[model samples]
Structure formats: C-alpha cells, structure tokens
Target: MTRLGYQIPNFTYPGIAADQLFDTVVAQAREADASGFDTVLVMDHFYQLPILGTPDEPMIEAYTLLSALAQHTSKVRLSALVTGNTYRNPTLLAKTVTALDIVSGGRGQLGIGAGWYELEHDSLGYEFGTFTDRFEKLEEALQIILGMLDGKRPSLDGRRYKVSDALNVPAPLSKIPVMIGGGGEKKTLRMVAQYADESNLICAVEDIGRKLDALAAHCEALGRDRSEITVSLQTSACVAPTHDEAVADFEAYLQRNPAAEVRRAGTVVGDPDEVAARFADLLATGVDGVTVNAPANGHVPGRVGLLGQTLAPLIG
Candidate 1:
C-alpha cells in the first residue's frame, strides 16, 4: 500500500476572509496533519497559477508558509510540491530546506523541478531562459545540493551557477528525502534514477504503469534499484457521501477551468467504497504513494478528516 499526501494549491477560495488567508491555510494543514495524511505540500510560485486563479490571487512564499505551518502542526511532512530550481541559488535553497527541517523536527522533504512558469519569472524579476537552459541549471543545482547533503563543501563553476566551498551546516536531523517532480522521461526520470529519493508525476492514470516501467529501465541503465525510489502521483480527488456529488464536484472543477482536462483514471471521485475501488487500480500501477489536490473542499472544516476516514485505510 502506498502512502497518502495532500496538496493545497489554492488559497483564495470562496468565503475565505482576506485577513484570514494564512489562518485558513493553517486550519487546513492542521486538519490534514491530524488526519492520516503523511505529507502536505504547496506550490512554489510567486503568483497564483492559471489553473487555480488569476495573477492576483493569494500566494505565499513557499518556505515561509511551510515554516509557519510546521510550528502549528506535528505529524505531516512538509514541502513545496516542487520548488522552482531557478528561483534561488542552489546553496541558499539547500540551507532554507535544512532550516525548515530543523524547525519541523525533521519532517521536511525537498521537492524540486525545472521551473516552467515564465510569467512569474518575468513579473518577479527572475531570469527566464530557454528550456535547455533551465534544465541545465536544474542538473547543476542538484549536483550542488546533493554534495552539500553528504557534508561535502562543493565548489563548482558550472555553466549556470558558481559556488565556493558551499557548505550546508546544521544539516537536517534526518536524511531529507529529495523528491524530484516531473515525468520527462529522457531527462527528468533519468535524473531521478541518478539522484532522487522520490519521484512525483502527474500523468494520465492509464500511463502510470508504463511510466513506472520507464523509470525502472532508467534505474537499470544506471545500476540503481527501482525499489529505492518511491513513486508518488499528484492528482485530483473528490470524496463525498455519494458518487453523484463527487462526480458533480469534479465536473464543476472542469467547468471552472477548461484547461484542467483529466482522464477518469487520474481522478478519484466517489463515495468511500467507490473511491477505494478506484484507488486500488491506481495503486496497482506500481505507485508507492499519492499527493492529492482537493483545494475545492479541503478547507471545509471536517472535509479532510472525512477523506482520511474513507481513504487512509485504503492507502499504504
């Protein structure tokens, strides 16, 4: 059985008071922690994503929010769904994550990816380069972070970044799992096989088994064991007392965001029993865990608890 995680992508939900934005996010995080959720994640973006809201929608700094949430919760692991590698220097990012681990009592996971949001980069004064440039930076950044994690003082003059005896002291209490998010098989999954502790992918559920097969091939080519890397999927989840309401909610989401097209295999929407049945198929695809985004109803008081009651037992 795979583990269960939750992601909160939208902070500007209907009826949430403006002044109570963090308050609302904290409430949801607390609920998930108390529930059976093992990990809680947020986006690492400066602006609201198009699929979720407009440019001005509420968006908090990823590390700042996670640090504050850590003080309020005790059980769940915390991280950005995938921190944009270009947003900060690799050494600085490592230090920030280490600090988060210290504050969270070692319940920190580092989720990173090659940045894709150009609008936020342009608006926030970040240098937005070509796709190849971004990937190069990500690859080099990983080298630096991994070196630091092993207590090495890495000095690299890479194409995208230069570091001088970069050291990450006061290291995490435990070995922080590095979660690489993306499914670009050639580069991303290859990198995962080389370095990542976990890999998170959002793809059509039908493709999951195939993706896992690809990952295994990458592992074999690199002489790495496939079982050493945990595979987690990020998908939409809707839990209701009846299948009809759950499907209705999923439909409402699609209607609100036409770009958010998803295959039925990638979505979980139904009553407890129905949800469990759907989840079984997903787990069968060799996924070791899941991080579901239920932004629509996650903040609704007992909604997260209800989801845990229904799905936690079914999850690994």
Candidate 2:
C-alpha cells in the first residue's frame, strides 16, 4: 500500500525555462525517491488543468515521463495519479503499463479513472461522451486491462469496447496493482470493489467518511473484504518550515492561478506542524493513505523532501 504518495500536478514553475522543465521534474522525483514517499504520481493530462493554469501551459505526456523517471529514481512506485480512460485503447494502455513495470523493475501501478475534462477530449479529437457513456466505457476497459495484466488474452464484446485475444508479450515483472480513482458510490466504488487493488477518492476532506462507507457497502455486497482494497484520498497541500511561510506560498499560488480556490475543500495550507494536524484529521476518517499535490511550491528544489519527511511518520 502507498502510505505516502506525491503527485506532480503543475508544471509551470515561476522561474524554470521550458527547456529545463524536465530536469526540474527529475530533481523532485529523485528527492521523493530518497525521502519517505512510497509512490510518485503525475496527472495524466494532455493539457494543463484549468485549476492549475491555462491549457497552453506545460504538460508532460504521462507514460513517457514516468518511463524516463524510472531511470533516475528507484523504490517509489510510478503512476499517473489517475489516468483518463478515453486517452487510448484499453489494450494499448495495458501494454504501456506493463512495459513501464518491466522498465521500473516491478514498481508501476495503474491509477485510472473514467474520463473527464471535456476540453481535452474535444480538442484532442477523442470522443467526449456523457457521464454514463464514459463510465460504461471505463467498465469494459477495466476488464480488458485487468485480464491482460494477469497474462490472459481477454475477449470482451461490450457496447463501448470489443477485444479478442489481445496479447501482452514480455508481461510485467510482477502483478501491477490497479488503482481506481473516483467517489461515485454506485458505479465507481462498486467497480473498485470488483476489480481494483486500491480505491482513490477525489472528494473533500469532509466527504471522506461518507465515500468510504459507500466503498465498504460495495465490498460487502460483493462478499469481498473491505480490507482488500486500500483507500486513498486525493488532496492538495502547501507545507513549509513555518506556518507564516506556508500561508504566504499558498496565497502566492492562488494569485498565479486565481481559479484554484474552488478546488480547496480538502486542501491543507500551513507549516509541517499545522499541516500534520490537518492530515491527522484526514487520517482519522478511515483512509489508509493520501496522495497530495503541492501546486504551490512543489517545483521548488527541496520542497518535496520537506513535505515527505514531515508527513511520513504521521501516516500511521
């Protein structure tokens, strides 16, 4: 299980040049590897998310970057925080993750979710369907992805996708864990109970208990042990050595991306002590772990290490 995970959601650092962007990212990954983070994630987006920056801002292709990161770091598992299902065919995604696992020496996890962000779908020429449509597609995709990972040629003739004898050669070095991300009690949590090794909820701190209850109910309905699925919350945080400094960094980031405040329900903004208090409250809600994105000052050198070490001991 990922007791602590670091998510790199924003790539537009204040002073970094475009040519130096990847090097900056590598530095953070290396720090995470050395620090206490058990997993390292990047958002799976073709364009910058609206909450972070404009679409034209830098967004690295997820798998390519993760594969590159595999060479520079060890120990921390690699994955997209939550990969969108509409980006590629299910078979292709399975192959991609398997290859990533092999390259990373069995340290890859597939964190996937039903596709959202209609803008990317529309702009990138992928189908932007309704909620039901996307979820149904994700259901079928999971079957194919899961089967392929287990070294079986899965054949599915579903409404959204159809695959016959899809083969994945050079299978993963080990069983690549599947993490399903969403908070939908009916479809999403139920699917997590049926097909996933982890359930990542993308809700506010206040909603964690309710979402987890729903997951437990789903697990019970299927006669599956709720403990079989590791629960994680996706959240935001700004941590520094001092409370005043962390608040300043948070406010400055809000200034750069004024639209970010709308997504602050689960956000923690303060020094290590203060942030640890907030995380303590979250951990009390029954989540097994957390994956936090530090958009405020994550790209700054040494920030990732500070956040990791500060929160590592508190995860238990």
**lDDT (0 to 1) per candidate:** 0.84, 0.90
Question: Lowest summed-lDDT stretch of 10 residues in model 2?
Answer: 258-267
Give me the overall lDDT of model 2.
Answer: 0.90
Model 2 clash pairs are none
Candidate 1, residue 314: the lDDT equals 71
Instruction: Please identify model 1 stretches exceeding 4 Å from their true place.
Output: 244-266
Q: Residue by residue across 82-141, what tens digits does model 1's lDDT show?
A: 999989999999999999999999998899999999999999899889999999999999
lDDT of 2 by residue, 259-294 (tens): 787756557888888888888888888999999889
Per-model TM-score on C-alpha atoms:
0.93, 0.97
Mark the 10 consecutive residues where model 1 has the least summed lDDT. Answer: 257-266
